[model samples]
Target: MDFRLTDDQRALQAGMRTLLAARYPRERLRAAVDAPHGRSEVLGTQEGAGAPGVHGAAEPAVDRRLWAALGETGFFALRLPEEDGGAGLGLPEAVLLFEEAGRALLPGPLAATQLAAGLVPGAADGTRIVTALDGPGVTAHLASADAVLLLTGDTARLLPVEGGTGPRALAAAPFRSVDPLTPLHRVRELPSPARTAALGPAADAARLRREAALLTAAQQLGSARATLALAVSHARHRTQFGRPVGSFQAVQHLCAQMLVRTDLARAGVYAASLTEAPAEIMGAKLLADSAAIRNARDCLQVHGGLGFTWEADIHLHLKRAWVRACQWQSTEESEEFLANELLMDAAGENAPGVWWDTLGEENVQA
Candidate 1:
């Protein structure tokens, strides 16, 4: 099937790129990382302060201004109902927006906030920066979020940061993050949440996890594509033995391999975005992780000494990709799940290796 984007989707992608290029430029990203507080100050006052549900303290790790920019574009409201003051879009649109965000290296608790819309106070209007903790991983942008959600199984516990409604946080401080753009912290224990909501039935947790994985996979796609371009550019310009590195067969093959990995990942992620089956989602996540990690490494290899330097942004993408790969789902877990899925299909279904289509849709409501 032809996987071309629709005219509207193309317009959406281009608009996102244009906005991000103007707001979250490379210079702004570095400045935020190098800033004293790990990010720029709150951009402005909340759009609707003193309203019944408004809380003006939900500044994210990036410039709250940028979050406001996203709010202006209805970024957080993408998946919400139009009757409930949202854009009334779907997961497909969200994944595409995230792909652009990843390419620009925009940083924040985007997934958490988008998921939190309409569920938590001030969440939908970008008045609240929401962050979530699932499994045993370091939560990013902890300092910026006004509310924290402890995601366990099919339940989400809302923990408000102010008025002592939040969990027993270890004294509100930012942990030094490997990816400076996305700061994180260690939580020893969380007592309980202020409010709780059932995520839904039918492996909703896994489905939500899959949705997160898909967006993250989009980020990985962006990272892979960016690094591929970086490597190819370096190959064309950088010379060795009085000739451009592109002339070398070894470098050519390395770039070719990177391209192959990226394209495969793109295909898988787009496909999984449509199906959203755990098996398909896991497959997409696995391919995305591999592409991002491998492409960054290959990009680094092509960049050689410059890539290794602290000044180089190549290492940043690689580190972030590494961190992102392990979030929500791990490579080991996804591999096992896919293996079992294949096994079940082979043992019980029509035949072994039935081309992955007969595995059945999870019908997960993400």
Candidate 2:
């Protein structure tokens, strides 16, 4: 399939970039990072306010104004059906928007909320924030999330965080996260004796997981691209020994390597967005994760000692990349999954025989 973006897609991507650059400037991102952690100015509480038996500390509220602006721009509603009041776009468009969000370091439960748009009430409009988790270990943005989408094997459940009275509840506890922009809550109990509302069956849940992984890969792609630009910019402007650092062979090589990795990951992500196959999505996640993490580290190296300071934005991108690497799918996990898939495909392709016997004499000897 063609991986190139259409003209309309390019326009959409440019529009998203413009919106994020205007709304989520570097200063705003710094403010969010430096904001008080425990202060709550919105929904959900430290206590078991939603479900009587569930409890957890309150997290910092999301930027309501910025969220509203995104909603008005149809960010969250991009993939929802037109009849349901959405932009009536597909996953490709959603991926483009998410890429811009990642580049801007726009905080909040963006992917979860976008995935929840049509499934959960108010999610399409951004009036309600939603976060999701698979099998409930640690979830992001739970305190501010109006609802939590719980993905179990072959099924999904919606747990309201603010005003849930269902028989089932999610017991949460405060957990420290490497990324300050992403608040986390550990879900100790989930989908108890009585299950929450079932939003979709096995097939839909599978689709959700695929989309989630692809979208997350897109975010990693964005971060990788952004850090590459930063590294290139710094190398060009920063002077060392009366000469621009970018002119040095070592710095040029680092920038080139970063660019290569970013482009390779971008290709994987774009192709997966179109294919939506399990292997493709997993491969994309792996490539994107590596690109984001390594590019940030390389960018830091290019920046030298100045990159380690809290004042610089390099560390923030690094931290967010680390956090995202664990989200949806971790590096090790994706590797294992991809490996298993390859093995499965090989097994399927080989004629009926002992798998080991099908190999060449060199392989057999090994």
Candidate 3:
């Protein structure tokens, strides 16, 4: 199938890339990391600084102004219906925006907000909102959200976590994630039902998982691309053995492998985004996750000792890739899903004797 993006899609991607480059450049990312709350600083602050409902000492504070700016720019309303104050786009456009977000190493309630915007009524117009898969205290929560969308297993609910601005204990968690830019929280307890009801699981859990997988794959693709670029640039500049390190055959091979993996991941993500099937999405997630982790390692190896230093930005991508690769769904989880799909597909088909024979022969050689 032809996977080329349409001209309109290309224009959208170009616009997003340009905007992110100008507003959320690398230096800005570094500054965000250095800020007091790390990635969470972008969320701004709630009233009653030390009160219970507010995020605790450990939570990474988010920058409120930046989030509002993002909303104003239509970043949060890209995939909703036009009637609901959205750009009237779909997953493909959303994927492109996410890719730019990944390259920028942006930190905020991006996924939750996007998902919530689509699922929750009236949330499409970039209202400050947050949703959580595991409920409060997780990676994405609406601590200060104007509204909170909760996906509790087979049920969905829209609840008001707080009023206007006040400290409220949504959830709590023990350990923090490596990507401090996207902080995870733990919900200590569930509050009263300010507005709560079970919405028939409007979307399949599998579909939601696929959405997470695809969006994450887009992010990983960007990370892998950025990392590969950094490694190649470093190789071309760093001198070794009286020539640039990139002149070495071994370094060239490493960079080549990195490029191949990045391309493969990108293709997989694009394929997954085009479909609604869960298995296809799982495959995409598996490919993207593998590519991101492997490419990051390969990139780090190419940089040699310098890549390990704190000053080098390679580790930031490495750490973020590692952390994100394990989230939404682990590698093992995706593999199991793929295995199940394969088994189901083979259930009614005649066994291929030749395939088994080939496998048996390979085993015998071993």
Each prediction's RMSD to truth:
7.6, 5.6, 6.8
Rank the models by TM-score, top first. 2, 1, 3
Q: Candidate 1, which segments miss by more than 4 Å at Cα? A: 36-60, 163-176, 193-204, 349-366
C-alpha local distance difference test of each model: 0.73, 0.78, 0.67
Worst 10 residues of 1 by lDDT: 45-54
How high a TM-score does candidate 1 get?
A: 0.82
Candidate 3 regions with alpha-carbon error over 4 angstroms: 36-58, 121-123, 134-138, 141-147, 163-170, 187-195, 198-206, 349-366
- lDDT string for model 1 (167-191, tens) is 2353433334556566555666654
TM, every model: 0.82, 0.87, 0.82
Candidate 2 Cα errors over 4 Å, as ranges: 38-45, 48-58, 163-169, 193-195, 200-203, 349-366
lDDT of 3 by residue, 203-238 (tens): 444456567668887888888888889889989999
What TM-score does model 3 achieve against the real structure?
0.82
Candidate 1 local distance difference test against the native: 0.73
Give the deviation of candidate 1 from the true structure as CA RMSD: 7.6
Best by TM-score: 2
lDDT of 2 by residue, 217-236 (tens): 89989999999999999999
Q: Is candidate 1 or candidate 2 better by lDDT?
A: 2
